[model samples]
Target: MAGIKALISLSFGGAVGLMFLMLGCALPVYDEYWPLFVLFFYVLSPIPYCVSRRVTDDTDATSNACKELAVFLTTGIVVSAFGLPVIFARVHVIAWGACALVVTGNIVIFATILGFFLVFGSSDDFSWQQW
Candidate 1:
């Protein structure tokens, strides 16, 4: 039941984050859809971890290297997600307000992703290994 509730909450957070991203792009004052590109980052953020998990042994206590690399890649993807809006704003590709909204969305979305992992990662019911 707790896991179900957590899943619902994470889903809600993801929706809210996407709402912010859409607003940043669709708002009348912003009128630019370039900020939607951040969605790619959001999607890419988890790939490394998923890949590494498949390549390495979870039961091995010394299997930190692959996991560390995944973490490193995830971090870079997240940072790049945050940085993209700023770069767009600096380059006048998007307004400052749009950048702020995109950044806010990035933070919320990433938090939700992490929350999903924290909440369901270890539970037998949520077998990420099958992903």
Candidate 2:
């Protein structure tokens, strides 16, 4: 099914992203675990949106305060995720090369998250809730 295929692709993307993250942190040249803090951002990024969705009612208003706040919080989390590596690099806690790799990983992981929502957040027959 399409949903199954989408799930598989998303999983692959997440795995690839995490691979990049791990490479940045665990590579002999970098050898710094400071970049691992971005994993917290990755975990926190979706919480606001999920919470808001659960607390608010779906309506045709085209805009909702709860959703907007959630988006804002999500944006902050994403920005924080991207910024942490740069901060680490600036402080010499990690190498610039590692920062670049971590940033790349963040991009891939966030894109995969967006793709998951786009694919499974629909009101169609194949909602992610089914899984």
Candidate 3:
């Protein structure tokens, strides 16, 4: 159960991380001069993540599951929310493509990290482990 939860959390985290990374790439491609708005989204991108972390407690199964679900839903909303900004910001297609690539890269990285954590975090006997 713990291993499964870790895997799920890792998957979600990776996906959200990728979304933010892509969103970052998109911010630069827009012709509109709203650096602040871009900055706002850039900053807001991590809000849910931070919140989710606070909500999640790996040691507690029930709470962890709840937090995971909350984080997953929140992440989806946050990702979709960016669409409005992209439209309003008047982002170019090329920039959008760049964002996609960045997002892809982030997702890959997130997955890797998540897998690492899943394995490391699952080991019951941490006494044998070394960072």
Task: Quote each prediction's TM-score.
Answer: 0.92, 0.96, 0.36
Better of 2 and 3 by lDDT: 2
**Candidate 1 or 2, higher lDDT?**
2
- Expressed as tens digits, the lDDT of each residue in 1-131 for candidate 1 is 87678878999999999999999999999999999889999899988977886787664676588889999999999999999999999999999999999999998999999987777667387655555
Off by more than 4 A, model 1: 58-63
Error of 2 at 80 (Å): 0.3
- All predictions: root-mean-square deviation over Cα? 1.6, 1.0, 8.5
Tens-digit lDDT track for model 3 on 26-118?
A: 455543332223334434544565466556557456656656665676466545444544554355533555444444544454455536544
lDDT of each: 0.88, 0.93, 0.51
In candidate 2, the residue pairs with backbone N, CA or C atoms under 3 Å apart (3 or more residues apart, or in different chains) clash, namely: none
State the lDDT of candidate 2 residue by residue for 1-131, as single tens digits: 88789999999999999999999999999998999999999899988988887788875659999999999999999999999999999989999999999999999999999999899988799886566
User: Over all chains combined, what TM-score does candidate 3 have?
Assistant: 0.36
